[model samples]
Target: MIPGMFDYFAPSTLEEATRLLEQHGPDAKLLAGGHSLIPLMKLRLAAPRVLVDLNGVAGLAGIEERDGHLRIGAMTRHAQLEASELISDRYPLIADAAAVIADPLVRNRGTIGGSLAHADPAGDLASVMTALRAELVVVGPRRERTIPIDDFLVGLFTTALEPNEVLSEVRVPSPNGGSGGAYVKLERKVGDFATVAIAVQLTVRDGTCDEAGIALTSVGPTNLRARQAEDSLRGGSLDEQSLRAAADLAAQEAQPAADLRGSEEYKRDMVRVLTLRALRRALERATR
Candidate 1:
């Protein structure tokens, strides 16, 4: 389907882009690897008068280690992350989610910033970023500010970014030397959105759980932190019984709606199952 008539601007510089955005305000939409926005435009679900294409901006497309963290450019594609040695070696959880996002073709073109800005409750990256404690760097008219992952995403299809802001980078804190992470998802089919998705990061030391980061996707209005579950595992052995107890607490926080994915009750149960599975695998990787 063709989109409605709209003016397009591809500014080669960041300053120029921000000025354009400030001029156009809410009527303008930033187009960054347009896999998400293009579909919405085709459906007429989004009808912005101006499309400010970010492709021309040079600095927004790479991954590098900076200040003891992985600083990923907002424009980096999912396929890039999936194949990156930096991600595979240090953050397998990110690689796992990136490899399974949409499909090969979609991953080839989908940008990290676009997905994060899209803020779809079911997207794999949002939940993974939450568990990883990632921070979003957004640039606006007067200044650039960093927002933590959980604070950046406010609700479904919404974010804390103002209309004139551009997400420039995503900074993920480096995991401790003995820590590891995992992502587990239950999709109806190979390419479908997850029925229940779980992301976990565990830091184990001397046969005890040091820290845990747990998050849920597709079961609420936003990507949710499993704080209760995380707290339960801290300072305890991550054995079967402890995992079961944490999973139960995580499941209790779910507010899923009945849909084609499954009944509400069914998804809640899967939350328990997947949470346990994700934590176990995460612990194995960390302990090795």
Candidate 2:
């Protein structure tokens, strides 16, 4: 179905876009890559009276290195992220997750900010960002604010962003010493949404886990940081026994729901299995 009729405004700058949103209020929607929003609009779930296209906005599409973090423009496409040498070298988990989002066609058009703003529980980027503890920069009529990834996602298809705010960039801290990360998902088919997804980041020192971050997706109302699992690994050697115990805690902490993709029980099981596999792979990479 076609989207409802709406006034289209392509703004050349973020200030203009935010002004449009302020003017239109709840009746306005910001259009980025439109991979996610357009579908909702076409389905009539979202019928904004005005579409503030951000494509024309300058300075919203690039990857840059700052003092100690990689700052990705909100409009940066998944395909771009996959192709970024910086990301591949320092944040391989992000690159891996980007490569697995839908198919090539979707990745070519989908924006990272769009994905995070949409806050889809099944989205790969959300879980990866959660595990990475990424920061989101948002601008609004009042002022600009930085939101932690954990606080940014409030619920399924929901976020902490105010209606008049636009997500400007995502900031990922550079990987610490001896750190490696990986994302693993169990999909029914290629390019399908994950039935269960896991992201693991480990900082190992002398064969002992100095730090660990774990997140699970598509198994809860929101992407969940596996705090219990991470806590289990910290200060311990990632031996087979400890890994198994952490995996069990990860599964226990999951709050999956019964859905068409899989039952909650099955999803919980996948969380356990995938968490173990991802952690093992991440550990191997860190060692190497």
Candidate 3:
């Protein structure tokens, strides 16, 4: 089905976009890549009165390094991220996740800011952001604020963003020495959302784990941080026994729902399997 009739406003500046949003309030929606919003609109799940397009807005589509963090403009396309030398060198996990989102056509059009703003629980990029402990920079009528990844996702298809707020950029810390990350997902087919996915980042020192971040998607109402599992790995060697124990803890922590993708039990089991695999791969890379 086609989306319902709506007024379009292409704002060349953020001030103009914010004014449009303030004018329309809840009746206005910001259009980025439109990969997520357009589908929802076509399905009649979202029917805004006006679309404030941000494509014409300058200075919202680049990747840069600032203050020890990788700052990505909200309008940066997935395809751009996939080809970014800085991203591949400093944040390979993000490049891996971006490369797997849908296909070439979708990646060429989908924007990182749009994906995070949409806050789909099963999205691979969301899980990676959670594992990387990224921060989101948002601009609203009143002022600009930063929200951590842990606090950004509120629930399925929900976020901390207020109706009039817009995401401007995402800030991810560059991986330090002895740090490595990986993302693993099990999908029924190419371009499908994960049935169960795991993203792991580990920092090691002298063969012992210093810090670990584990995040799971498509297994809960929101992207889940496996805090218990991460704590289990800290201060321990990345051995077979420790890895298995952490994987078990992660699987137990998952609160997956029974859905068409798979049964809750099946998803929980896959989480165990994927967690172990991701951890092993991350550890190997860190050591190398």
Candidate 4:
């Protein structure tokens, strides 16, 4: 299906792009990788009057570590993340997600900023970012600001991005020697969206859990934070019993509806299994 007719603009700078977005208002859509928006447009789910292309904008793509944070340019490709030594050595959780998001074709062209901005509940990157408690930097015509990933994601297919704003970067605290993370997903097949997925990040210090983050995907209106599960692990020993309890809490927290992937009961149960697996992997990485 062909997308509806729309005017296209290739802005050389972010400032110019934002100005175009502001001028076009809600009818303007920014083109990043176009994986999300183009499909919607083809299905007629989205019909914007103007398309503002960001490909020409410089300085919107890179990966760097500075000021105690790992900064990923919004336009950074998933393949880049998957292949980065820095990400693989320090933040393997991100690499895990990037390596499995859709397939090679999608990863080759898809952008981190585009994925998060799309805010699809099933998007692998959203849950990963949530588990990392990453910060999102957005720029608009008037100002630039940072929003926590939790707040940036509002609901299904929704985000906190204003019409005139562009997501500029994602910032995550650099992992210490004791910190580790993992992403565990259950899909029907290769490149399929997750039937149930879990992302876990853990910081272990002196045989105790110093920090923990647990988030779920494809089981709620948004990427669901397993707060109770995280709280259960924090400041506690990662014993079999504690891990089981946290897994149970995460399953309980999921709000899955019956779908083609599986029944609600089935998915909830899978959440328990996956969460336990992910936690175990994360703890091993943290301690080893």
Candidate 4: minimum summed lDDT over ten consecutive residues — where?
A: 172-181
- Could you estimate the TM-score for every candidate? 0.98, 0.98, 0.97, 0.99
Candidate 3's residue-wise lDDT over 1-288, tens digit each?
899999999999887888889989999999999999999999999999899999999999999998989899999999999999988777777887888888889999999999998888888888898888999999988899999999999998899999888899999887779988888889889888889989998889998999898999889888899999999999989999999999999999999999899898999999999999999988887888
| Model 3 clash tally, residue pairs | 0
Superposing all C-alpha atoms, what RMSD in Å does each candidate have to the true structure?
1.0, 1.0, 1.1, 0.6
A best-first ranking of the candidates according to their lDDT comes to: 4, 2, 1, 3
Pairs that collide in candidate 3 are: none
Candidate 2 overall Cα lDDT vs. reference?
Answer: 0.92
Candidate with the larger lDDT of 2 and 3: 2
Error of 1 at 189 (Å): 1.3
Off by over 4 Å in 1: none
Q: Which number leads on TM-score?
A: 4
- Residue-level error in angstroms, candidate 4, position 131: 0.7
Highest-scoring model, lDDT: 4
Stretches of candidate 2 exceeding 4 Å from the true structure: none
Q: Candidate 1's error at 168, in angstroms?
A: 0.6
- Candidate 4 C-alpha lDDT tens digits along 1-288: 999999999999999999999999999999999998999999999999999999899999999999999999999999999999999999989998998899999999999999999998999999999999999999999999999999999999999999999999999989877988999999999999999999999999999999999999999999999999999999999899999999999999999989999999999999999999999999889988
Q: After superposition, how far is residue 59 of candidate 4 from its true place, in Å?
A: 0.4
Model 3 regions more than 4 Å off: none
**Clashing residue pairs for model 4:** none
